[model samples]
Target chain A: MPKIATREAYGKALVALGEENPDVVVLDADLAKSTKTIEFKKRFPHRFFDLGVAEANMIGTAAGLATAGKIPFCSTFAVFATGRCYDQIRQSVAYPGLPVTIAASHAGITVGEDGASHQAVEDMALMRVLPNMTVFVPADAVETAGAVRAAAEAGGPVYIRLGRSGVPVLHGDDFEFVPGRAVEMRRGLDATIIACGLMVAQALEAVEQLAAEGIEVGVLNVHTLKPLDVQAIVDAAQRTGAIVTAEEHSIIGGLGSAVAETLAEHYPVPMLRVGLRDVFGESGRPDELLQKYGLTADAIVDAVQSLL
Target chain B: MDTEGVVAELAEKARVIRRHIIEMLGEAGSGHPGGSLSAADIVTALYFKEMRLDPTRPDWPDRDRFVLSKGHAAPVLYAALAERGYFPTEELATLRKLGSRLQGHPDMKKLPGVEISTGSLGQGLSVANGMALAARLDGRDYRVYALLGDGEIQEGQVWEAAMAAAYYALENLAVFIDYNGLQIDGPVNEVLAPEPVPEKWRAFGWHVVEIDGHDFRQILAALAEGRHTRGQPTAIVARTVKGKGVSFMENRVDWHGVAPKGDQIVQALKELA
Candidate 1:
């Protein structure tokens, strides 16, 4: 399979959107190179604004642009993009329900070496709790591109979380992404593995590993965290009889908590959450951090085995 | 209207807005009264004399934008919007009530004339910069105005926005700082001084103007200067009394966010009349 970073896909998708829509403007808070919004800046110099290292100002400016009929895509690292500017997002963007796409790159523990300060483990929970916000955690490069395009078309506040590290491309060119819908990657009746972001690829590998041992594990990619595919999760839980959730984020408020809340409300199912258990990340390689945080194929398999 | 005529009309309008602010705050029995009264003249001048707006067409693309960055002054903005016929003036009584369009803070979605929802300090200037940039991008000449409290600029985000406005050279944007010098805690100087405010804005590459915030002529002249400025944004530092018009409430820190009670409301209305 081809390999690409979700941030790279986001950059390409933004350039494409800018070309198609003259109203599409891009803003970055001094992280254009890292966030991959330098691509959009290079293409449309006039429409791109580099707002220095000020996330709150960037979000407020994006809301103002939205009010003036311009669709703004504001980019920065996830930690600064959501946490640093949360009040600005709530009061300016979400309060008015502006069509500002917050393209937050380097989300989750996958943002390695920079340590916990840079990694945004709670971004999903923070954005999910906002009244008018739609949170998207795309599985791979293809889905990231689809998510960017979808956010541009969807005239409201959307937060598209992108990764810093490159992962294997899991979707084909014809892959369609529907917001609030889950895609089942593998079929099984014994147990279901619900995941998002880098964990989707890891869950696929875990499913294959579990299959070789006469265990049939289902894999479901929950790309959209808010407006989550509740029906799909409930159906998967009903058929599989057990559930496991995996992500490159914290177990407290990321994919695991979202899936658990859905199942607990709709159908009570025995479950195990595979991710960091209320701990911050540390300086290490991307793969090392994933392994240390218990966010790998082996961890997902262990979670499934424990549930079974 | 002639210059004197415009000034007098605006002054009377400011009085009406001040009366409404007192009446509405007393009705709600809760709200920030000091900031609302202090901002009355500036907001009145903008909505009644300066801004090119049609109450019937609130979504006019070319309409000048006003963002109340010091959003606790929603009573003032709501009063001005109602007086301008944006909504029924009777709705002024519904502020902070359940399901009222007049939220405790200005809500752009709830009120048609509100350009941007702002209650959080230090965020509106950045929003104004975006609107100015959008005007430039869309090839329109609409101007953007933002009102900020003096103490509100203490938030680090305000400086971030101030820096960006100068960097962008947003000649079409104007910002007003209601330098009433009192916050809820105490005097803004004793609390956290944002003094040398004019120099700070000038250092940030803005055309700095200082004036009496309650003087309609000065307010109108400064706004005109801001409109004519080129290559950089303008910051108008308007020195104002915390609670203007009501003699006992004026400059009184206790009245900052407190609603006037029965005797206080009667005295305030009498003073305004």
Candidate 2:
């Protein structure tokens, strides 16, 4: 499978959106090159604003531009995009329900070697709790392109989480991404693995491996965290009887907690969460950190096995 | 109107705005009165004389923008909006009430004529910068104005925005610092002195202007200077008295966020009348 970083896809999509919509503008906090928004800057210099290393200002400015009928895409590292400017996002963007897209890059432990400070393992939790925010964690480059387009077309505040490292493309060119709808990668009966972001790819691999062992498990890609497809989760739970959630984020408030909340209220099923165990990420290679934090395909397999 | 007539009309409007602020705060029983009262003249000048706005067309793209960065003074903004006919003046008493468009803080979505929702200090200037940038991008000549509190500048984000505004050379942006000297804790000088405020803005590459905030002529002149200035943004440091027009509350720290009670309200209205 071809590989491309989600941030790269985001950059390409932004350039295309700028061509289609003259009102589209981009803002970055001195990380345009890292976040891949420099591409949009190159294409639309007049519409791109490098706000220096100020994330809070970038967010508030984006809200202001939205008020002026400009669709602004504010990009920065997820750590700074969500945590550093959470109050600004809540007050300026979400409170007004502005049509601004917060395209946060380098999300989760994939931002390796930069240590805990750079890795935004709890970004989804910070954004999802807001009143009028739509959170998207695309599975790969293809889905990231679709997610960015969706956010640009959908008015109101949308947060698209992108990874720093390249992941295998799991969707084809014809794949269509519908917000709040989960895509079932594979079907089975024994257990279901619900995941988002980079974990969806790992869950797909785990499903293949589990199938080799005569264990039939399903993989459900929950790309949109907020406005989660509770109906899909319920259908998967009814078909598989057990549930396991996987993500490259904290177990407390990412995919696991969202799925658990859905099932606990509607279906009351046994489950296991596979991700960071309420601990911070450390300096290491992306693969090493994934293994150390039990975020590999084998971890998903183990989680499914534990639930069964 | 002639200059004298304009100043007289604006002065009367400022008085009426102050009356509205006091009555609304008294009805709500809690709000930032000192800052609201202090900002009356500046806001009144903008809404009534300076800003090009149509109350019926609140979403006019080319209209000048005003952001109340010191958003706790929402009573002043709401009063000005009502007096400008953005909404019914009767709605002024619904401040801070359940389902009232007039929230304790300004909510742009809930109220008309509110360019940006601001309650958290130090965030509005950045929003104003964005609006100015948008105007430039769209090739429109609309100007953006932001009002910041003296103590609110203590937030590091304000400096970040200050630096960016100068870097962008936003000639269309004008910021006003209501230097009333008192904050919720105490005197801003005693709490955390942001002394030499004008020099700080000048060092940040802005055209600094100092004026008496209550003087309508000075306020109008400074705004005109800001408009004519080129290459960089302008910062107008308006030295104002906290709780202006109300003798019992003027410059007194206790009235910073307190609503005036029965006798106090009577005295405040009497002084304004």
Candidate 3:
């Protein structure tokens, strides 16, 4: 079986969308090669814009294009897209409710050799808080492609978080992606391990390990963080006595925070969050950082065991 | 458009806009007056005489668009919008109050005529550029306009947008600079000078125009020149005086954001009358 990264899916989807919609435009802030928007640029030179290290202007221009009824997909490293140009997104895109799809690539520790500075773990949190903003984190390449299509079709602001490192193609190519729905990957009764992005693979591995120990650990892939499926989380919490949420972000405000917020209001249960704990990531290898930062399969299994 | 009669009408509108700014600031007790008063005539000319905007249909697709890049001076734009019938003129007194759409800065979601929410300086031009590019891609004939403050131009992103607009030869886009010389800290010469603004814009490949921003005839004439220019974007460097109408606040840094007291408001309105 072949494996691919989520960022590649973004590039593929951009080409596909560009072929279909003439109003679709691609913008890059000097990372066309890295973010994989180069494919679309090559195919449709007129529709592609290389913004040259101006992320703020890139986002604002995307908003502007949307105002003129054009769907603009802006691609860049997640750090610059979310952290550096946050205000531009807030005022220009989100506030006006423009249909701008921000395809943020190289998210989280999975970005590997670029180290902590390039990896964007806090994007989910930052994008989630903005008014009228939609957040989606795909589990694999197939799902990322589907999310890009969904964002393009959806008439509003959407943020698609993608990764640089290659991972298993768990979902088949024919799998249909929904914007605000969680996909139940495994069935169990003991505990539910909700995960997103690359963490889904770790979570599945944890479930397989826990099954050997006679623990029926369930796994759920929560791709959409905003407009979250509150009922699915409540039902999962009801079916399983405890829940373990894992993500590549700070525990203070991100995927874990969104899950916690929903469960607190609707359904209360014992929960354990496995992610960064009020500390900045340091320069290290991808796998080393995952282990050191407590984002591995072992960490997920431990969190589930602790919750039980 | 013949600019002679239009200039006189816009000049009178600019006077009323200035009066509106002072009165509203007095009611609010705190608001930017310097930049707002400086930009009154330029914005008034765009809204009343230059742009093809329908006050009734604030979201008309074919209508020309304007983005106030320097948004702290929203009072001027708001005054112009009210005068143009985007909203009621009497509601101007409710500026910056709780539950009012008239926020301290422009909020596009809350206000109908505001194109983009701006306050954090140096981002609006990029947004206007986006709109301009969108118009071209969509094959729409409507042009886009943006106004910038002298002090706000100090932000590097403004230059980034400047370079991009000229690089694209966005002939449908026009930018204005309210060269009032005064910012919050002090005179721009004392704080951070943006001298030879027209030369800088020309160097960036834009069709630069130097005009007396307060002279409504000159402002309209420059705008007319921008319309016929075919190859590049136009930047009108409108030299203006901060707090152009009010006697005490003119050229004074202290009046940058401070509203006048009740007695002062009476005197200011009297001057306008």
Candidate 4:
């Protein structure tokens, strides 16, 4: 399978949305090239606006456009997109329930050499806590495209988290994206690895590793973190009786926390969360960072094995 | 324009809006009276004459839009919206009440004619710019107006919007900075001054217009100037006294966020009446 960055897929999806929906407009914070919004700019020059490194202003402006019946997609690095403009999102977009899609690229430690300053380990947490926000951490390029289209159609405040580096394709062209539905990658009776974002790729790898070891472990890709697929998570816990959640974010407030809270209430089971554990990431290559932070498939396998 | 007669009429409207502000704030028992009172005239002028609006169709596509960036002054905007018949005047008493459409801040979802939800300072201007940009994109001729407080400029996002509005050359957008001279702490200049206000706006690529915020005619003319200007957003530096109308509250910093109580409300109502 070809490796494609989710940000690249987002740019393509934006152009398609721009063509289909005349009301769709794209706003970026001067990181058009990095966030891959340049393609949208090239195609729909009139519809694209570079807000000049002002993420907060971009959010407020998108809120305004949404007020007047225009669907605006705000693109920026995940760190700046959520942290810098959280109040703007809360006051202008989430509070009013505006149809503004925050396309946040360069999420997680995979931001690599940029170090912890540029990484958004808590972006999903920030967006998920907001009342009207829909959070999506698409696993691969194909899923990213489908997530963008679904977010645009969902028509409220949405946060789509993307990565800077290319990830292996995880889904087919025919894969449909539903807002709060979890896709079951594999079925296992021993344990299950529930993950979101790029970590889903690692979960699949872990499933393969566990299969070789003759330990049946399933993988559930929870793309939407805000309107969490609670039923799927409960079902997974019931089916497997042990679970492990993996994400490219801090274990405190991403997929791990979401799954834990759901299980603690509905179906309590022995589980472990595999991700950054309160420590900040250092500047390194993407592959090296994953290995250093214990965010690799080995980490998922270990967590699942411990849970079982 | 029947200048005296027009001013007299809008002045009456302003007086009524001011009365409503006092009454509502008195009822709410906690609200920003200074900025609300300070912006009553400019807001009154817009709702009464300057902007093209239909009270019946508050969401009309071509109607002019208004955003209260200094959203703590929502009482004044609510007063104007109520007076303009967007909602019933009796609902004025419900400001900040539980489940009231008139929220503590301007909530577009709750209230009619509120173009965008704003309470945090420095965000409304960007929203106005978005509305103006949308108007241009959709081939509509609707204009957008945003009102900012004197101290609201201290927020960094304001300058970001300032740069963006100018860069976009949003001719359909006009903003009013209610230069009320006082914020919560103390006098604006003494507490992190944003002085040379008009010059700063000019430097930011806006067609700067300074006016007495209380003057009905000047407010209208400046808005007209904004309408005539091309290739740049206009900024009207409205010189206003904090807590303008009420004699006791005039230019008083203490009233910045405090609602009038008992005798204060009585005297304020008597003065406006």
lDDT of 1 by residue, B79-108 (tens): 999999999989999999999999999888
lDDT of 4 by residue, B1-273 (tens): 588999999999999999999999999999999999999999999888988999899899999999999999999999999999999999999989999999999888888888888898889998998999999998999899999998999999999999999999999999999999999999999999998899998999999999999988899999999999999999999999899889999999999999989998899999998
Provide DockQ values for all models, in the order shown: 0.91, 0.89, 0.71, 0.89
- The candidate 2 chain B region of ten consecutive residues with least summed lDDT is B260-269
**Model 4 clash pairs?**
none
Question: What lDDT tens digits, residue by residue, belong to model 2 across residues B47-119?
Answer: 9988989999999988999999999999999999998999999999999999999999999988999999989
User: lDDT scores for all predictions?
Assistant: 0.93, 0.94, 0.89, 0.93
Error of 1 at B222 (Å): 0.6
In candidate 4, which residue ranges exceed 4 Å CA deviation? none
Residue-by-residue lDDT tens digits, candidate 4, A79-183 = 999999999999999999999999999999999999999988899989999998999999998889899899888879999999999999988899998889999
In model 3, the Cα lDDT at residue B230 comes to: 94
Q: Give a tens-digit lDDT track for model 1, residues A1-308.
A: 77799999999999998999999999998999999999999999999999988889999999999999999999999999889999999989998899999999999888889999999998998898899889999989899988998898889999999999998999899999998889999988899999999899999999999999999999999999988899999999999999999988778888889888898899999999988888888889999888887889999899899888
Query: Order of candidates by DockQ, top first?
Result: 1, 4, 2, 3
User: What interface Cα RMSD is found for model 3?
Assistant: 1.3
Mind giving the per-residue lDDT tens digits that candidate 2 earns over A97-207? 999999999999989999999999999999999999999999998899989999988899999999999999999999999998999999989999999999998999999
Query: How large is the interface RMSD of candidate 4?
Result: 0.6
Model 2: what TM-score? 0.99
> Candidate 2: where is the Cα deviation over 4 Å?
none
Of the candidates numbered 2 and 3, which has the greater DockQ value? 2
**Which candidate model has the greater lDDT, 3 or 4?**
4
